[model samples]
Target chain A: MFGKVVIYGVGLIGGSFALALKHKHLVREVVGVGRNPHAIARALQLGIIDSMASTPEEAMRDADLVLIAAPVAQTESILAAILPHLEPQTVVTDAGSTKSDVVAAARAALGAHVAQFVPGHPIAGREKNGPEAAIPDLYVGKKAVLTPLPENAEHHVERVAQAWAACGAIIHQLSPQEHDRVFAAVSHLPHLLAYALVDDIAHKPHADLLFQYAASGFRDFTRIAGSSPEMWRDISLANQEALLGELDAYLAQLTTLRGLLAARDGAALNSVYANAQQARQRWIEAIEAAEAPPPPPQETSE
Target chain B: MFGKVVIYGVGLIGGSFALALKHKHLVREVVGVGRNPHAIARALQLGIIDSMASTPEEAMRDADLVLIAAPVAQTESILAAILPHLEPQTVVTDAGSTKSDVVAAARAALGAHVAQFVPGHPIAGREKNGPEAAIPDLYVGKKAVLTPLPENAEHHVERVAQAWAACGAIIHQLSPQEHDRVFAAVSHLPHLLAYALVDDIAHKPHADLLFQYAASGFRDFTRIAGSSPEMWRDISLANQEALLGELDAYLAQLTTLRGLLAARDGAALNSVYANAQQARQRWIEAIEAAEAPPPPPQETSE
Candidate 1:
């Protein structure tokens, strides 16, 4: 699908994309660019990329696509460094979690070539980081949301969409603002809450005892709290407005529940719990149904 | 170890305990008691009990041990119903999540026979309920907390500990207040947060989109929200003071995080996330170490 693809900041998401592209034969050559020479060398050794480059200029020499797969906070600097080296026809895109900041960074760095950039976020990752954590099928069965701006060329958006499709990702299109709002509520807010809860518990006087007695429920709820601190901090700040809105909404709900508890209102508490339980069950059923294979053809009756 | 063991309100915890006792050959006979006749019948059919009784009085006949594994709200009623039938030698205990309330209920109902009761909580369960969800190894390698009162006989507490030990549980002793306070911080608070988060998102204007975009992180964070609403509601009310305190503490922490976010204090945010990530990692390592089998005997060169 492409002659050569260059990926910046070859870590978990970036390296995974390179492997997925190679495994699917979507690109003739995968080139990894990173400041860490050792990580780039490791990516090459791990077969995550066909070659490695210390500079984007060398990597994008003959590239048909450029993917800025770095952290959101680093996207601007990466774009500034790579924009001058990019070919006019090279369709540039990113896999940043926060889209608005990336879009703004593209506009500031790409100049006339802003029409080539597409902002995207693939909703897949693990707690582990680095190139060694990369997998060829990481994007399979996951959603990749694209927020293309009005300045972006239609052909560029189409090319990026096809690239993600080749990686086995389902694509969804939305405005930058909408993407930020939705993700802040569903993804970012929960992560912040989990982190806060764990921190609070750890600082308590009986933290050791509390952790000792914690079971599966506590483990699952706080699993996201173990995520990369730097990555989450960047996300929390980049999407501050939407995330703060979500946190406020969640707090209001919790306060209402506290009021009900103080009033000893069993019926209200039961209703709230029932509502959440039923909603979660429905969500789980939907996910299961989506993942289930199609039914086999029925045998004919003679 | 036991002649006849009677389990009241046979469900996941109760049925699992029965199976564990039977598997260990610790009890000669097991009897099931519940208000739901059909559930009792199902338990019997599933071999969760040797016999099914219509009332605790019939089940407690010739019983050496009785386990009240009902909801906290129902514990009082179960105690009231079974108090008149209990023998002074019968070692009675409960498997309720909250301890103080169950202890109080036993005192109110058992009167002079209160010394026979031991309050306990097995820190193991699944989202599924009823006898169908019961498994013999559910309590294996899990923590079983026993909160015994001063009014209870020492022998009764020792018997309860022995029973749980036979089930492969590591028993931890604590005061009722300490147990409630610790659990409120770790278990109850997380469950409430999950429920509130799910409920809040479900009521939003873009709920469908939010759920669709939610990936593994959100799913794990909200898994506990799918628990039995009636069970959680009863627990919330039963341990009202402790849970309320936890909710308040959590809210205060969140509010402080909000302040940091509003000010865009990247350093403070990073510190919070890093603290949580480190603490969670330590806790996970501790659990793995506890659950891991002892290393094979070191080679001896004589």
Candidate 2:
């Protein structure tokens, strides 16, 4: 898909992209940029990328494709730093979880050339982080949402789709606002809830004992609770409005549920439980039908 | 440890226990009793049990130890049916999730003989069920709570504890009430919440689209929602009071959270998120430290 590619932040997503590029022969030369020299060295040693760029600008100097995979808050600053060095013909996109901020940052950084940039979010990752956590098939059968700018070139969008396709992603197109709203419900909100649930249980009087008794159900539900606090903090803040809206909606429903249970309203509780059960079944069937393998069993050999 | 062991339910728990008994060299013979003749035959064919008994009465005729592993609602009826057949010297016990109900049933059915019937709950299982999901080390490093009758004989209690110890379980003696309350927070209540969450999402106007965009986080959060509805329904009904209390409490907290999010109270939201993150981390660390290899993943070698 491209001759040379530059990834600005080579963490889990970035590192996995590098691995996928290798798998599909999508790019010939891979350049990585990260703040930590140790991580850069590790990525190079692990063969995640071919070389390390001394700076963001240096990374994009000879690259045909530029991917900003930094934290959402850092996207604007990094884009600012790399824009001056980018070739006019270069194509740029991001692998951020949030879209609005990144899209706005790209517009401000590239101005008239903003069409070259596509804001995208790959709906795949693990609780684990860093380049070491990157796996070869990280994006296999996953959804990658692309929010193309009004001026985005058709060829550029096509190339972006092609790159994601090579990485084993099914592409979905939406506007930046729609992408943010959808992800807030599908991803961001769930993460926030997981974190909140963990916190609620941890601060309880029987915290240690409760944790001791936490079985597979609790472990699975709260798995994302162990995510990078810094990254989640940034995401929670960046997508605050939509995430908060989701939080409120979930809470309102939960409150109504609480009332039902308190009143020993068996019919109401049973109705909700049955509905939830059926919904989850349909979702599971949809997932299974997609023929996507689960991320390898946790703590098992990948 | 046991010469003739009778398991009163030839399903996942009983069958797995039989396999574990053989694996640990704790029993000479495992006699499985089930209402379903086909399940009994399947259990024997799978080598989960050495022999099959058509009725609990037949299975307990010559058994020195009897473990009832039936569904919560059926425990009382099964106990009543098997009580007359149990030898006075038999060390009877149960592997039910909800202790109080099972304990009450044991007391009602066996009267003074209840002292021989220890109510136990093993905190382990897989999403999959049946003898097919049976693994010998299913209880290894898992918690097994025993709620013995207050007048239980020392020898009977010690025998039950030893049996669990042989299966590599960490045994704890708990009051039935305590067991129910604790598990309500850690296990039952969480399952209820998961089912409710998934149901709410499914009923949403955009359910299909929401699911299409669903990623690992939602999948993990709602994983328990895919659990056997029949089993959970029985559990929820059995532990109704405590589960309802926990659910109400959770709902209240969720409502408070909604208020904070609706107002975009960043500080409050941050506190909730941070607390959850910290709690989840501690819980995971504790579990990892205590784990002794999860009995090998049950990957069917297709």
Candidate 3:
């Protein structure tokens, strides 16, 4: 529990963190800070935050915790801006989609106090963005991956984990390299594929006709294409190496599929599809099992 | 209105067709036939059909309409089996996902009676299968694309269109070639991409970890992967040429994306994402517009 928390970039992630902490009575006050004053004002009006901080110094004053939930592109700048005012007692973390970039930014900005920062990425969100999209339950039954740096003190990292745990999230730790690699396969690659499909179709002469006839399958497949463009671009660049590796692997998979199609190998094609169907079916079953998100990792390896 | 309807598959599509027809009181009786006698029995027991027919001959008797909603692989066989029993008054149609192959099968098997067969693809479905998955409103507010043969009599095609209309589907016409091409771009390509992504991840050594971290985006993106593998295999081969073309185009699009990533061209990458986001947003808005499925096509091109 914290007496005061500062949430910079009071959009969906920041706003939701504020609400989640308050929902559990885990914090006495939530101070909001953002480059867009109007958004901060809206957060206050929406009861998402108790107060608005016009400056990083003002926001950091007596702040027990600082959650930088801005776009990954602003991670370094925000960290640098708040570093001068950061207190030794304050534990800092971020909800950025990419971990290695955030870790690098924290190291570059926090100097000797870099141990105060714990890199985190919450695997929860909706297609909508901004403060209005924030929900107290966004992280409930969800996983928050923390990639603690070598310099991070154990207690500081634990505080960050506890904060996410208070928000009903199940905390897991992965090294920055592993986090980037795993997410590159599961998250980044799929986002790129969705965006590519939509953008490719949109560039066509018959794009309208294609979109018009697109039914439920198309709707769900391309839903992620509707995500924030700027945010995805930042994540894409930050994790470029891992994502490109994934794209290459996926392209290879497509080539094998093309070979099957070329040969009219229905049996082979069916096998591939059946394998995917089984795996995806199992994944859905696990998701719908109605059991809560897995309890805190049995015996933290870290 | 039909005096009696024969549905040869009794799976999701055929069963839903029966339920929808009965729901609208547009048919006097619905007869089901399938290789799976148990499923056919279930269809009758569930009231999705009024009777079970052991053979095409039995089902064809007194049948005003025969809907061959079986897998695409069985198209020619079903057409061959039913041709002798298909009466002059019985207009035949199919609910296959691919049009060109069904048209070919109709020509090869129906011969002179091919004119009675109208190729159609209902632009709707669920991930579930079997008679239990059928629903009366499955086609409500959905578009059913009918690729009418040039040899078909206008009245026969009209009867087929009327059957779908009774089930709350809006009818539109396209040449078999056009239908396959457009669907390859919109439907088939997306399904393959989804299946490919899931299969690729499933094949990896860290598959469990990747799947564990996969959230809502991956779930929606891969939802189609859980579809019947045998059915998709048939569709892929049936619409092979068109699908391959679309796949090539998508591969090219992915190459462009790879270039953007390699160059770290964040601005261009953002623009591509923004374009897709805008188009998808507008399309979703149009779908959400309070108005119903576009009232039957402006004018029948045929």
Candidate 4:
């Protein structure tokens, strides 16, 4: 709970966070700060925020919380712009996909105030972006990862965690490095591969025919490729080292498969497929078990 | 449209076709032929077929149409077994993923009766298999590709098309070589990549952590990897050459991306993602347009 919450870059993630805070009455007033007047106006009309401020200085003047929800590449500039205006007690946090760069940026920009910054990434979104796409329950039932810096104060981390919990997000903690590596393998790499695969087919001579015959499997596999290109492009570059490591690992696996295919090793191929299939089944089962409601309280007999 | 429709290998595709045919009143009788007595019994009990026959010989004795919906690797043997029992006028077609090998098998097994066979690859299915997973509308609004041989009569091809049309499938005609190449790029190659990606993560040191953080994007992207391993294994080997070519092309694209990433060429990466995003949008629009119903008739000034 806070008196005034300032949300910078009021797009999908920022607007959604503002809406969640407003819905839960966790903040007395939600103030949106962004360069795009049109988006800020839309957020106001959508009731995602109580009001709009043209500058971070105006928005964070008396704010109890400041959420930097801009693109990862812009985190440094946003922090630099807003740090001078923030109150000493204002807890600063971010909703960036990549963490290391943001942590580095906080160190460079916040100086002594780095203790107020808590790095966070909520693993939830859709292909659509913008304030109009924001939903009140976007973070509900989703995992919100917190990668706090060594300089972050315990109170700042606790406040951020409490806010996300109020939004119905299950929280997980990881070191910045571990967080980057895990996300690079599971999220960033899949996005890059999907984009590459779609572009490969698009460049083919028979692209029209190829796409016409592509069924639901192809559609589902490439759905992420339809996400905001600019955002993903920034993420790919910001987390370059970890992403490249993942890409290499994935390529190595593919190479092994290529060799097996060339050698016509059906048994080996079957083994690989079976292993992947069983692993996916296990994951599905785990997720289903977690989601399944507790057996109606056991209905103990009197 | 037929006196007796015999469906060999009464699993997902075969069972669905039988149910669709019966639903459309396209056949006087539906007979199932499968080695699995339990599955055949389930098919009969579910009304996916009117009756059950223990062997291909018994099922094809008076069959007017026969649909072989087994795995691609089994196509040759199934043809060899069924040819001796098929009535002279029987118009046989298959629902295998690969076309060239099935055509080859038909030529080798049918000998003089090869003209009765039509090589087809229905572009439809789900991760689930077996008769229990079958549904009447499985092929509705889906593509069913027909690749007829030079030895085949036009009437046989026409019959297959009509049957699929009755099941609400739109039919496309392509040469066997073209069919295999297109599907290799669109379907087979994607499945292999998904399987390889999943297995790569499963083999990693931090596999549990990686999978725990893996979100909807990874789930959708790898959904096809959960498919029947034996069936996909057979398809991979059956359509080896085209798939290998595709894998090479895909790898070449990835190599280019790796270079751009290493060089930190943000503009180039953004361009690739933007191009893919736009192309995917166009494909989505095309599909939506095709699937959209005709506009309501305008009211004239009466």
lDDT rank order: 4, 3, 1, 2
Q: What is the lDDT of residue A19 in candidate 1?
A: 90
Q: lDDT of candidate 3?
A: 0.91
| Alpha carbon RMSD to native, model 4 | 1.6
Candidate 3 chain A, which ten residues in sequence have the lowest lDDT sum? Answer: A288-297
DockQ for candidate 1, please give it.
Answer: 0.92
Q: lDDT per residue, candidate 4, B272-301, as tens digits? A: 999999999999999999999989999999
Please identify model 3 stretches exceeding 4 Å from their true place. Answer: A290-302, B290-302
Runs in model 2 lying further than 4 Å from the true structure: A22-25, A36-38, A44-62, A84-86, A263-275, A292-302, B23-25, B35-38, B44-59, B263-271, B292-302
lDDT of 4 by residue, A158-274 (tens): 999998888889999999899999999999999999999999999998899999999999999999999999889989999999999999999989999999999999999999999
Worst 10 residues of 2 chain A by lDDT: A258-267
User: Model 1 residue B168 lDDT?
Assistant: 87
Candidate with the larger lDDT of 2 and 3: 3
Give the DockQ ranking, best first.
1, 4, 3, 2
Determine the C-alpha RMSD for candidate 2 after optimal superposition of all C-alphas. 7.0
Best-to-worst TM-score order: 4, 1, 3, 2
The deviation in Å at residue A74 for candidate 4 is 0.1
What's the CA error at residue B59 for candidate 4, in Å?
1.1
True contacts kept of each: 0.92, 0.65, 0.88, 0.85
Clashing pairs in 3: none
Model 1, residue A173: distance off in Å is 1.4
Once fitted onto the true fold, the runs of candidate 4 whose alpha carbons sit more than 4 angstroms away are: A299-302, B298-302
Could you give candidate 3's per-residue lDDT for residues B124-165 as a string of tens digits? 899899999999999988999999988989998999999999
